[model samples]
Target: MPEPQQLEAYFALTEAVSLLQHQVEQQLRAEGGISTVQFQILMALNGAGQLTMTQLADGVVYSRSGLTYQAGLLEKAGLVTRGPSPEDERATLVAITPKGRDTVAKVLPGHIEVTRRLLYEAVPAADLRRLRDIMSRVRDHIREEPPRSAAPRRRRTS
Candidate 1:
């Protein structure tokens, strides 16, 4: 890839992910009656069985307070339960409810269909392994770095 194309590629990939998220968000809301963030929380909890409040927030890229608010909503909907961690009184553990599992089951077909339409169909099967390898490497590289905001800014001079 050329230098200029690399820049365009970065923006293109970002936009593609954003657009895919929007499409999935709509499907989740229409079919499962959940927001993208809620679906993300449920999805993570579903896979992990249970996670600490800190873990949940980190996995979903949400702040602790934000996760608390969303968790409250999920709890009110009877989709999840939050309780004190047995290992640590100060920590909260979140687990999915039966209703949350059912919601995931109901929404999975649409989710899969949209993912296929947006991604699987676009990439050739022969290159999928390579694509996955590249994506994983990129994710790891970025994940290892601190957020841009956490880095100090250089001094400005007139």
Candidate 2:
């Protein structure tokens, strides 16, 4: 069992993350008509220009089927496009459209403001530095597991 202080720290960290995610989800839905996962996918595509379905699944830490569903929604909304990759026939490439870029640009400022106001405003500069370092280490440790893309898929039921 963890010490009392360690348990408190873990709980606090989890609660903080949940609250932050809620705020971000609300903002994304209101401002961009997109969910947090969709926003993540868009941002990833925007940054990387284009990526395979596997790449997106791995980068977003989302399940392959869920990513496919969200990507379909995005494509329907004219925010992204899905196509076969030239280099690999087996791969499906995803790319953000001009509309997608515009949507991201429109929503990004509010996202930044909300993040800064909610997260940054509460922490001192020195503590923020420590938080960054600690979180980075934690993230690296957690990511030592095999990536989502490498995980096995569930078998279909009859």
Candidate 3:
């Protein structure tokens, strides 16, 4: 059985993350005219230079189709480009455009402000390090298997 403290911790973490995400997403949409998700996609591609669709989805914690839709928005805005991967005809690649980099540059200040206010200010310096360590371990454990929502369902035969 799971311990009570463990259960409490899990719920607390979920609540905190959900609340923080909601706040940040709203702030980004209102102040920056982009969703938090769009910012994440841009951030990943900007930092990595380029990534395949599957890689971008995994990096951004989104389903391939969901990534496609969000990438479409970015592309429509001229912030990103999606095209055939040079090395793989069967794969599509996503990359940040100069405008996308510019968008990140514009959005980063407000993003950092909200993030700092909601998260960094809430934790001590030492606790922030501990939080990062704990979250990294949790992220690794979750990535060890298929995502529950997007994973293919198993077949059963009697």
* lDDT scores in order: 0.88, 0.95, 0.87
lDDT of 3 by residue, 61-135 (tens): 887678899999999999899999889998899889998999888888888998899999999999999999988
Candidate with best lDDT: 2
The TM-score obtained by model 3 is 0.89
lDDT of 3 at 17: 89
lDDT of 3 at 119: 94
Q: After superposition, how far is residue 58 of candidate 3 from its true place, in Å?
A: 1.0
User: Which residue pairs in candidate 1 collide?
Assistant: none
Better of 2 and 3 by TM-score: 2
Clash list (residue pairs), candidate 3: none
C-alpha TM-scores of all predictions: 0.85, 0.95, 0.89
From the highest lDDT down, the ranking of the candidates is 2, 1, 3
Tell me the number of clashing residue pairs for each predicted model. 0, 0, 0
Candidate 2 lDDT score at position 53: 97
Candidate 3 ranges with C-alpha deviation above 4 Å: 146-158
Per-residue accuracy of model 1 over 17-113 as CA lDDT, tens digit each: 9999999999999999898889889999899989988788767777666889999999999999999999999889999999999988889899999
